[model samples]
Target: MIRQLPLVAFCMMAACAVPDYRPVRAPIPAPQPEPAPQVNPQSAKERFLRAVEANGCEVNASNSAVILAGATLSQQDLARILQELKDEGRGSVAPDGTGFRVNTGACA
Candidate 1:
């Protein structure tokens, strides 16, 4: 019983004496992002239309021709979309009408 008590006391002391080994953190990185380009929505839309036409008129190819399908954007629809995009404040319009690039600089 006396030997058992000494062993138990040594076990308890060993457990409470453990060393902490926390790792050091690396330095914070600087924001290296470039400022986004700004654009006017109206001008952008016009440019997009031009880009659409510039595709050798291919914007009206089998695929897109189907989407436009004998429909023309009315004055009200155009205004609504413009306002909505303005309220939402950001989106991408393909200048070349092939791919889109979004800019959060708030439609110029």
Candidate 2:
């Protein structure tokens, strides 16, 4: 019985032994981004008038719409011409000017 008790105690001690366990590591978070700034330019009519000024051409008033000097003038073509002038940085066709002379429908 005494030998049997020692064997049982040994078995109990072995069962109660502490286990070795490694802890798990946590994951990292992602980074956030910022928004871009906006660019506000002059209106089409203003840009076209600027183009005309940059071209150093005058706008003559007559029965047939304000005529653009030198080139064949069209209402729709005015806006594109102005935009081109702005890109090239030509002439003094600024939105903030003393006189408000426009060919009318230049923006159209």
Candidate 3:
């Protein structure tokens, strides 16, 4: 029993005096938000119509055509709008002095 006593004491002392040697860990990062989706711009024809409406001009639509008056538009913008209307087969555009007209053609 006396021989076992020293061994038991040594074990108890060793267990109580042990030191940890592992590296410390960093904290977890917070979650981040996703970016918003990209949106496509409107076509030239649609843009032109919107511009006309924004200028307080009247937009008259019938079964065969759309007519507007008193809306100022640039020549380049007008040409693009006309081309867009033609390519889409939606209609054709015509400039009448101070206003513009759109013939819906088969699209009507």
Top model by lDDT, which number?
3
lDDT of 1 at 20: 65
Give the runs in model 1 whose Cα sits over 4 Å from its true position.
20-45, 48-52, 55-108
Which residue runs does candidate 3 get wrong by more than 4 Å? 1-31, 58-74, 80-97, 101-108
Q: What C-alpha lDDT values do all the predictions have? A: 0.48, 0.51, 0.53
Model 1 clashes, total count: 1
Q: What tens-digit string does per-residue lDDT give for candidate 2 at 16-93? A: 796757686776666667666676566664545655445434442332243333244566666465556556554334
Candidate 1, residues 1-108, lDDT tens digits: the string is 997999999999998898867787999999899978885455444543443344332332333443233224444544454455446654444567563332333222
Query: Which scores better on lDDT, 2 or 3?
Result: 3
Which residue pairs collide, candidate 3?
Answer: none
Off by over 4 Å in 2: 1-66, 95-108
Residue pair clashes in candidate 2: 50-93, 54-91
**Clashing residue pairs, candidate 1?**
39-108
lDDT of 2: 0.51
Q: Determine which window of 10 residues in candidate 1 has minimal summed lDDT.
A: 99-108
Evaluate model 2: give its TM-score. 0.27
Worst 10 residues of 3 by lDDT: 62-71
